[model samples]
Target: MNAPPQEEATSAARVLVAEDDDAMRAMLVRTLRRAGYTVVEVEDGFELGDYVAMMRGHGGTLAPPDVIVSDVRMPGLNGLEALGRLRAQGVACPVLLLSAFADEETHAEALRLGARQLLDKPVDLDVLKAAVRDAVARG
Candidate 1:
């Protein structure tokens, strides 16, 4: 007998989050999911790179996330560095970079690296949702 047809995945936006803080990561995941987006949570930029590479290795069979939300500082590569690398690799997904210690230089660098927005830490969930929505619409 043939297997039953599977239902299509929801058309909700896909958002990948890279944050080292457990509590903050959880909050982001919860908020984004509650907002009806498909959220992928990672611990740091290194893991974020791994996820992106994995998707690329699938040769376009797997779709990359519509947006990436990453913290400025982490154990491994920082958000700016990761964003630069992703851009170098031709990943065109919009990025929303979050930082507790962001400065003017960092903001400039993020813009140079093609980040869609730089959000300071203790981010407001509503603002984040709006940014994500804007990123998706722009893309």
Candidate 2:
């Protein structure tokens, strides 16, 4: 047996959701919480930056979230740029990028910049859960 599936995460994993769409962001947060994760929400890149900085300034809240799930396209700054900035700021957390328009080029670039996973939109819940688990495991 491949060691039966894990029922719970090794750590208390929290997730940070960076999505500009109100409904989508809310849905992602709800879905994650239902899967037993703690979640925080950020609407855009600047807000995302502020959250990370706050966490860094103070040790961090809820372990700085084990993973970051961001929408690919957003106002002000997009997900890819956010990921790059986070990396520049020494964020080691795994980031999963989501896009309604996920094409080969996008995936290649995101992986190159260290994104842990990518999900094409409409967001399947089961797959999302599995991806979250794997990303948290990697962390």
Candidate 3:
């Protein structure tokens, strides 16, 4: 017997979320969970980098998440910088960034960093869900 498509996809799909705002992070976790994804939360970009490093093995087995959703403006090591570090380290998981204020340069830089999408703050839940699903499917 096989599981339904949605269940099979979401059950094994791990999503790492990096956001500094407590309320916003909670909302994101709740939303992703309701959408059936296995979610991991990190409060800032530094934590995000450390987790990614650990996932890259740290002398263990490689266990990268299916996708990463992050806030562009974190307290330290912002999302774009983290993404650059991940690329430098050869961790190529898809990334989606959230920003309350993204300018033209920011958008261009995000694209250069290979981010899948740059979603604005106060994001629509449905849009976020769809983007995550798309990123997972593409991976």
Report, for every candidate in turn, its global Cα lDDT versus the true structure. 0.84, 0.84, 0.88
What does the lDDT come to for candidate 1?
0.84
Q: What residue runs in model 2 are displaced by over 4 Å at the alpha carbon?
A: 1-11, 57-63
For TM-score, the strongest prediction is 3
Clashes of each: 0, 0, 0
Error of 1 at 72 (Å): 1.1
- Alpha-carbon shift of residue 73 in model 1 (angstroms): 0.6
Q: What would the per-residue lDDT of candidate 2 be over residues 23-61, giving only the tens digit for each residue?
A: 989989998888888788899877876676667624566
lDDT tens readout by residue for model 1, 5-44: 3211223678999999999999999988887779989997
Candidate 3 off by > 4 Å: 1-6, 57-62
Model 3, position 123, has a per-residue lDDT of 98
Give the alpha carbon lDDT tens digit for every residue of 1-139 in model 3: 7755865976689999999999999999999998888999999877887786676534446487899999999987799998887788777889999999999899999999999999988899999999999998887
Residue clash pairs of candidate 2: none
TM-scores of all candidate predictions against the true structure:
0.86, 0.84, 0.90
